[model samples]
Target: MKKKLIFLTNIFLCILFIRFVSAAGTAGSLNINIIESQCLLDFGEGWNFFSFCRNLIDKNASNVFSSAENNYRYIMRWNQEKQEFDIFSPRSSRNPVPDLNDDESYFIYFYSNSYLDVNGTSPGDESRNLVEGWNAPSYQLGFSKTIDSLTLPIEYQYRYIMKWNLSRQEFDIFSQKSLKNPFGTIDQEEGFFIYSKEDLILNIFNMQ
Candidate 1:
């Protein structure tokens, strides 16, 4: 009877161990889903090095280069002057400056890995912080506010805000000096190069 009891205890322990292993494997696989998910990038805070995808340009290199984690790539940046993309790859001899302006939102691609997981990510912010310099910032026009409806100080009225037409790919001057129609509406997706007289924060709340 004692021998029978020992055999039964051993069987129970073996079953428990198998179940624990199975659960652990399932959890590991779930991490792959997080890596494959899409995340938005906001340039409101500032420009910095970003790893938008899970595959690194150099597969054998250490994960220290990628802030996102192991098996991730640094992706590419845009050249505003050249209107071209500066991509990072092992084959490229010269690497261009990786910087993105607030003028537009970009879509990033990634290589999927079934073995990795992403713990958390920040998509950036809708609002932007500006210093006492030229800032090319874009914000979604909220509530269809007309140019005239927007209020600014009398001193900063003329030439403070420059509106961009995405379709034309050019900026149309709008200021008190130009005497442009204040009733004209600005698109939210369009970028506005604002010349800040002082340090201030620009927030675009009503963006879809």
Candidate 2:
């Protein structure tokens, strides 16, 4: 009788341990699926500097801008090699910009307050190649981070970082060597310009 009672107790404890492990695994999977589902961004009237923090199912400019078709005026992307703005207007018959890339950023003009709701997969371990001059790159994370917290290679050097001021219609600049910097944090919904002294890859890990 004593041996049988001991055996029964051991089996009960083993079953509880297995059930706990299964529950924990299911919770983790649910969290990952929720994080990768969609990204929501808000845009005010006039020019707004923006970028998508996820990889959309359709990257075409038309499909991505479908939500704000009536409110948006145009979307302009900076041409790094040509040193000009590639404009894409819904009203125009011929648009210079066709596709919206994950690594690049754009300046979008809107007539009224609107928002972009993008359903896409999460961008895992984002990285961008910076040239010797100005580069308009997007922050590919799902959360906000300060400029000082960004990790860069030892050989890479940044001269300045600038973010567009939507209300004031100006650029908020942040310099590493400057005593007074206006822009410090980088928001996930917006994009910013960075000047690099040399060519290097900017790696941003997705901590979400």
Candidate 3:
């Protein structure tokens, strides 16, 4: 009887894992490590963005983007009803709290830098807002995404995709002028800096 119960428990755990991956869809798992300081970041893929924010502000007592008077983080969670990403200041009672959905993601600036040891399996997705200048971003997938897959327009006068090499802990620049293959794959959880010709929206949510 005890052996049968153990077997059933294993089965249940497997189902939960399967559900977690399926829910994340193209964005895949959220596994990241903060080896350095001084950077704004998106919730690693497959995470409930608001819950992660609350965990930092409420549970961990970490400052995300708040003043001493109002301890909290400036997190943006996608509003499906409104079809837009809205800012969330945890200290404010009027803020509409929303879940960071499986097919969406947002960015947060952490002024009070601290080491992060992230480990979990909750479903999520990826999206990045690009302004007409250098912007730091990361891909929250278990695998890499190729440049061809990104469909970057070569006609854009000023463009650059600089991917951070996690293994070497360095930056790799990709541009039309650069002889290095611009069509290489940008690996999972690899933070990058992009210089866009104009304002743009990047959606890796549908990437597979």
Candidate 1 vs candidate 2: which has greater TM-score? Answer: 2
Candidate 1 Cα misplacement greater than 4 A, ranges: 1-125, 140-144, 148-158, 166-169
Question: TM-score of each candidate?
Answer: 0.37, 0.79, 0.42
Clashes of 2: 0
Give the alpha-carbon lDDT of every model: 0.37, 0.73, 0.43
Quote the lDDT for 183 in model 2: 66
Query: Which residues of candidate 3, in runs, are more than 4 Å off?
Result: 1-117, 120-125, 151-158, 165-169
- Full-model lDDT, candidate 1: 0.37
Query: What's the CA RMSD of model 1 in angstroms?
Result: 18.4
lDDT of 1 by residue, 122-163 (tens): 223345555665555444332243554433332462246665
Per residue, candidate 3 scores C-alpha lDDT tens digits across 1-208 of 0000011111113212222346547544544433221222233222112122111212222233323223225665544344455776656666554343323334443344323333233224546666667655445554455765653442463477765432243456788576775336655444455666776677665356
Among the numbered candidates, top TM-score falls to: 2
Lowest summed lDDT across 10 adjacent residues in model 1 is found at 1-10
RMSD of each: 18.4, 14.0, 14.9
CA lDDT of 1 in candidate 3?
Answer: 2
